[model samples]
Target: MPNKKNFFLTCAVLAVTLTAGCSSGADAETSEAGVDSVAESVGDAKGGSSKSPADSDTGRPRIRLDTTQFEEIRMYQGYLRCLKDHGVPISVKGNKMPEADPGTLWFPNIDVAEERPEVEKACLGKKPLHPPELDPQKNPDYMDDYSKWIACDNRRGLKVDPLPDGGGWNYKPGVTQPRNADQIDKECMIEAFGGE
Candidate 1:
């Protein structure tokens, strides 16, 4: 069994892998089962909701995960702005938002655990909603879907190999990825995993 620290690290790496569509130098030995375990642990930690807030008709604000990484970064900037406006003392570097701590993706870095409630209340509507297709717990077909995502990338001329068993992909070692690779990745991700 993976320890909590390693699991959180895997989650962080997985997030980067998903966004970048390439290995972030994480262990290639990390298995699909390990990812499943992490997803299950996260679901358990969050009380195992049967329906995500996006799926529920509960009158909650829900942002889709169908956007590009650039768009998502813009949203994160808004979240940081909201936190600072709410007196969270978040630090920003030039125009970029601060990196999220592992396992607390999208949440601002608050030093005190007791401040979470206040942060949550202040940033209620700005939280990013994970689409079911992109969520391992919600989509048991996540690996297969990722394989299709690789196929989509290949179709778009990205010439990358999907990591064995579906964790991520890597560019051909000697080949230079295109200058517009980011745009291609955004389009492929939307086609492969974006939710309606």
Candidate 2:
């Protein structure tokens, strides 16, 4: 989930950016299956040594998997975030950059087969239990008609940025406007995202 502003922007943007909706299927059972498959491969590759050099000091090995490239690929980020949020100890290896994919996540404490369901239910559910503000689709306060509404911001003496077609508005970085920015932002959102 994203913050309020980001959430609204994403809602507007996603209509353009994503051609298909996503499916969230990771659960304890699926996680266990994935872990077993990886474990077998790793076991064979390193004589069943699950410990990597980084985690060897702890004597508790971790299961790592190469995941997708885009952090905007919310499915993986949401899954990992859900795992951590629910107190499942996880370690992400490699540099995390939005543009870079194939990062790894390691589960240190989970007995992949036994705890997979708990993780799925707690952190891998259909919605992944994001904070309320992060999900604009569920937020009662979110606005929608950004195209016509942005004009209101421009008229209010706010230095507003343009919205891309089928996308949301973003302020040009480092730009300044009125001192009452907080209120102005709310007004802008209301105007931009409100019904036509």
Candidate 3:
């Protein structure tokens, strides 16, 4: 079986890659809930290190947290550090990374918010990382069901885009919908599709 952290890192990397250069309006509350859940699952209650390094761009030290279980985050952090070293503007969600833990981390698309052509060019030179295989089959019935699910969300006052023509599902793109679209209660989907 795949390591669970690797699995999530793969999924998150894929999501981030697909949505690269797109501005994010992530739902702060929803994201906090996820972090809290992860913290609980990992038995960690401590917040990340306090006091960003004095040289940090915001004149505030960068937050650091231990992410021992998710090793891939270290590389992402290295990437961010590289960008910062090269004068690229970046921001981490909630301004934190797990203390001492490295291997995976999350950040908004700096490319979308910053205009550092040199830094962007440098980032492009690095090899791109791909997520593990997660192909979801898209048969007609699934598409039809997804359509209904989207409709249900719309009816419930959740803003969701229509699934593309083939109507396949992937991590959603763009910030036009709710920040928590990925975690919208599946009970609504169940109510809409009802086992199809």
Candidate 4:
């Protein structure tokens, strides 16, 4: 039979050995995991051209993922304006640049707008949301022919619709006729010119 001191000493040594082994194993695993994650992060950081650090003089890769949604600036401004006109508070929708489609622009997770019936009405016949003047597909004030439309803008032809079918007839601040395209009492502008 072992003495009491010897037995206690053996137990202590065993415990220390087990703990040291487990910690060393854990540290090795952690180091391997960290290296793997760093490599993955650098790989994902590659930009459109997929250049490496040594490939260019920059010694760093730029990442610009084209994965973003769409946003209609004019329509959102109108929405906010309409809310202010009606004495209601307005909030921002998505902060990211919305993705582009054939016609629709998607902005997900708009806050404080869920309870607004006016905003809901504003978004009718379209996804996400947009003010009326912006939706050429639905605005009664603007006729549709895809031709007679003129994009009057202080910021170039960023917007397009029939010229005389102009509902937002008067814009404030910086404003002027379109430098890109012009139109008159034409197809969609029929109603805009007092219905043909």
Top TM-score hit: 1
Highest lDDT scorer: 1
Worst 10 residues of 1 by lDDT: 31-40
Q: Report, for every candidate in turn, its global Cα lDDT versus the true structure.
A: 0.45, 0.38, 0.36, 0.27
lDDT of 2 by residue, 1-196 (tens): 2222333223212211221111111222223211111122236654565633222112111111111112223334445555676677776644433233445453334443366666554442322222232234554543334544456656765555654542335554575666654345445544444332
- C-alpha lDDT (0 to 100) for residue 39 of candidate 3: 13
lDDT of model number 1: 0.45
Prediction 4 TM-score vs. true: 0.17
Listed per candidate, the RMSD to the true structure in angstroms reads 12.5, 17.0, 16.3, 31.3
Please give the lDDT score at residue 138 for candidate 2: 52
Q: Can you write out model 4's per-residue Cα lDDT over 74-117, one digit (the tens) per residue?
A: 22333344444445554443332233222222222233245666
- Model 2: CA > 4 A from native: 1-5, 8-144, 172-175
lDDT of 3 by residue, 1-196 (tens): 1211122224334323322111112222222111100111223368544432221222111111111112333334544555655765555534243453343345545442256665644443221232111112423365555567667666655554553652223333453655554334243444434453
TM-score of each: 0.47, 0.31, 0.30, 0.17
Task: Rank by lDDT, highest first.
Answer: 1, 2, 3, 4
- Model 3, residue 66: C-alpha shift (Å): 21
Error of 1 at 104 (Å): 20
